[model samples]
Target: MPGRTGARHAVVRPPAAGRTAAPVAAGLVLVLLVLVVVRLPWVGDLGMHAATVQRLRHSPLDPGNPLVDADTPSPYYSPWMLLLGTVARVTDLPVFAVLRLAAAAGLALLVTGVWRYVKTLSAHRAAPALALLSLLLLWGTTPFLWSGFPGLHSLALTVSYPSTFTLGLAFHFWAWLTRAVRGAAGWGVWLGLGALWAVILLCHQFSGVVATAGAVATVLAARPRRTAWLRPVAGLSAGAVVLWAWPYYDFFALFGAGDGLEPVHRVLYGHPVARFGLVLLGVAALVPRWRRDRRDPLVVFFALGVLVVGAGWLSGHYSWGRALPAAVVPAQLAVALEAVGAGRRRLRAGWAALLTGALLLGGWAQAGTLGYVVPRGALPQALEDRYRPPWTGYHWITPWVRYGDVVLAEGRPARQIPAYGPYTVAPGYPDFFLPDEERRTKATGTYFAERTPESVRRGIEREYGVRWVVDRTGALDGTGLRAVARGPDGQVLYAVP
Candidate 1:
């Protein structure tokens, strides 16, 4: 807040032509994203999210383990998903259709939130539009695809995820918190902010971390009077109450269950140069801002993100890598701000040129995302080579598998089968809260073992109420199971006799 006016005091407005072109470019990028969402390609965790919606639609109050047939609490039962579930139940729309609606809403919130937050930093008309583009396309040439990171390719794949919605709300939260701290906001406003903070956390825990870091950075940069401290404390207390009262899952308990996630998240630390080299441009922008004001919000925010992520790597809690956005966003915003705010015209032009080059390279690197909206064959050879095909899904098994029926499957099939309303014997993803996760996983392996006795396989099926078995063809031929159907990639659905 100290630098609210100081940071933009020497600002120089962009040219009229630039003012017109920035928004046009931003709008076109958004339209491309809309097409990607409309297509809803099956990639990453699509099956998991689809299954989560499927379960919630049938039993909103007690939608158990999303991937397995167990009465366990799931962190995925966020307020947003619950709302989507309600909409699905009322309209009887397919789960994927509801997800598309969710994607559109999340995208709108994200774009508007970015606009509002950028306005708080600078008054320039083109700043917001430039910030939007930088946030999406200023990453390194490498295609880093993840749920929380908003690199063009990643956002295209995870447009419908709860992480996207949560992150969008995070931007709004930071903007509002910055204003509240700078002004004389009443206790009621602070309390509402606190509750909103908790809701964001419940919606997506990883993004919640990013939001909390930004909130902390905002308050620190504001340098509020000692007497004003009570307001933030009060807000935090209110948020704690909401987290405790939420009945769907034990949000606090997740703190102790991160060990199981280290293996998967370790990858986030890999390929640092290819994934984040472009951020150095923003780092350069931040040096001047930091010199002008030690407590500059973007500088402080980037430091906090780096500290958290570095600690995660050193401490082996790689799940903390999700907070990478905290660092990346500030840097991205710095580049956008410097492009228009530099006092010297030459400096501004140089920054603008650098930014434009980075955007072009980033965009081309992520061009493969077009495969989601257009046919791969129609794409140029270079683009096609970069394109990764999406999952074909397990719709072929849906005719033989009924809703709520358990299926004994492993690997990719296990991941996708539940999207159609059936549960797998073991979860394809990590399940920290599920009490019987290890047992269920072991049972799935035992059932599919080539040397396991037929009697043992039957017992395992009876134990879990598995009505169908999906595996490679001929894997269960001699087990007295009847073949139900054959699916893509040589997978066969067999009935458990």
Candidate 2:
């Protein structure tokens, strides 16, 4: 894509116009790698996303259900994921390996994006370095990696849920910097639309509302030379078509619809307090400087983006993944704008130091959380959703299901779990008549609170060929059920004799 090439050309230019200062930019990227050290954010949503992409290799064009269909189940992401999926299907890349690759790609995109935009304005060989450095610093933070990590692993629309958000912001910033660099009198609505449309679709159809507001905000806040709609409309259409054609969206929603299962998109992904602070800082930084760039529309565009995100959350469910790109993209751009405009060398240097410190501190704090106590608290399910241990998913799962435990048992991800690999939990409900592959293979029986349906109890009895049951204990409640372990959450045991 021209986007990638453009950034490279700009950064690798001849040293004539204060150009050869790539070291600083490289340094920035190195420092921001704190998250990698902590292993805070797994690239590619880590396992599940890689699992889905790998599953689709055998069967493509699935229209049934994204989550249920192993071929293309990742609904939260866009279709671009299939590119990797194809590789998985053909070459047999392990899910984790694919995730690492995706993560690396995402890093490359973000770096290139920041470099090009910053290069447009920076001179003295240090400008691109400074801008690149700032972004690197931001990425360096643990929280930032956690927040942005999804962009790599999630397939289009699915992963783009967050990537688009980030990409949208990056797009807007790029447009702003392009205008500033090109020395054009006005911003181009057309260039901005290229990413905006994709962002809207990526965020979900509702994000269109946010996109609309951003258009108005840019017009109101930033002065642009041309207001032509044709070019923008055309670009937007193309991007949208690309997104629509991807199979990730096609299968997940249609075939897999159910009452209880929730897509990760429905829930907010960031800590409320933490995200709120980020929001406030963005506003504080941008608003105060708006008057200075009153003629520049990025400020107003940012304001509108913020409002829509907050409002979107209040009116409907809020996903931090959806709102973050809008906030961080502008916030970082504004920082660059301020530093670039500082005029005095000393002031620019000082501001740069302070900003770098803040970002690094944030990154440090983010990484620190993962050190010891956080993992127990931060499992995606612990803070954000309810999660049950995988059926037949304990350490001892190896004891029963030989080929594999009941895990890798079902779903689009399950098929890829190596045949008979009980590693992944097989489904439980919706068919009490049939045992979840894991439990069946492991000879494990289901026991739950009052919620356990009679049919399920009967199914348990039938499948295990036992009498008597222990609903109170975690173990098989069959006639052989026996007491083993007990806790406030529940009890443990075997089938009672």
Candidate 3:
């Protein structure tokens, strides 16, 4: 699709009035840039997602309950996984490899989306470049500078998350909506928006809500004449809700109604100073221009998104709150860039060079730190490689563990052990939000905290159908379980005798 400015059906609007035209080359470079930045495949969500995607490849229509042994139905909707898995199968690459490629594609889309969003919002020449640079740099500023380590949260969204990619798709949806408001969009655009709506929901529920809310807020806050587009907006949203009714019902029934789970007080993610700084600058720039661009849909969208996200955080909705940074950073950057670009004549070249230098240096440092922490393999190579050590010997466990054969494990290993292999943890709830109180209580009381080895074994067998115990600390020696395999580090797989 050709770039169109001013919501007219014009197809020849370049990014700026007089920029060189190498869009294809630029796209290739952006993809290469993203591929280089995202070197590793595995991350926090990849294990479960990859495992699920791999399964869905075999049975694309029905990825029957991933966490249980029986054919228990699940409410999860994973169009992202289905698509990624299809790509992997077609390309004959490992699921992890395909995920890496997907990450690169997502990065490219985000870059393109950011540029387009800025172009649609402002006529400033430097806005697109500045926005793109701001987004790509210093995502680890808060974590790295404050805590001396790169944060996993930013990396997860940028490299592995389905919702992260949706940021781009969401922006594209916004652009089409902008066109729709001007009566320039066709039925095809409306159909496309509907498809994007479904894609966002199927990818990540939290981000999906965020996108919907942003669009709704923008539309509702639109000037009177633009409000006509609200019909399509409302129709698209209601259609999405109706189509995904079952999944939504299941999600609320099991996951959203967090009745028994302990109140999670900690924020899973944080705003990196570099990114937040850009948002602050955007807000500052937006203020002076408020009189002129007050009615811009993108302007209203950002304004409302900032307010809503702030309210969510203050209200202790941390899951959604934590998502705000990834959800709004790109748009915020565009706003700031446009603000700055509008006054380019007053902007100093020295300051621009300085800002660019700082962002590039910050990106380099974060990438170096990321490489150190990101482990190798779907499971860590140390754990996967055989004959390295008894601790290293556990890599063999995932394949041997039969489907629904309940196992006992914890931490990262626990999340993957069941998905990569057929085994399910006693309390192997795939989604932490969808807690099975009974199963969790049983595991906590009898299996994880048993006073004696015999009690632990008995509790496992009775409550969880657990036949294997993946002990990392060599603590299950006297539990009447044989050490089926042991790694060099002494992590052992104990079979119930």
Best lDDT among the predictions, by candidate number: 1
For model 2, the superposed segments whose C-alpha errors exceed 4 Å read 1-45, 63-77, 121-129, 132-227, 243-284, 295-297, 313-316, 345-350, 369-447, 450-455, 458-473, 477-497
- What's the distance in Å from true for residue 381, model 3? 24
Candidate 2 local lDDT, 1-497, one digit each (tens):
11132222222223343334435545644444423323324322333443345445544555222222122233544444556567666777754455556545555555565565555433324555555544433432223333432221122212222343444345444545355333433335444555555554553433444344444554444334464434545555665665566545542243333223224445554555543343334355566466655744447666666675666566554443355445544565566545444345675556555565655554443433322223445654423232112122122322332332223222323333332222233332221122233444343323333455656655655544433222333333443345443323352323333
lDDT score for residue 469 of model 1: 91
Q: Candidate order by lDDT, highest to lowest?
A: 1, 3, 2
- Local distance difference test, per candidate? 0.89, 0.42, 0.53
Regions more than 4 Å wrong, model 1: 1-11
Q: Which candidate is the best by TM-score?
A: 1
For 348-420, candidate 1 gives per-residue lDDT tens digits of 8899999999989888888898898899999999999989898797877776678999888998888888899
Q: How do all models score by TM-score?
A: 0.97, 0.59, 0.76
Please give the clash total of every predicted structure, in order: 0, 50, 11
Task: Point out the worst 10-residue segment of candidate 2 by lDDT.
Answer: 151-160
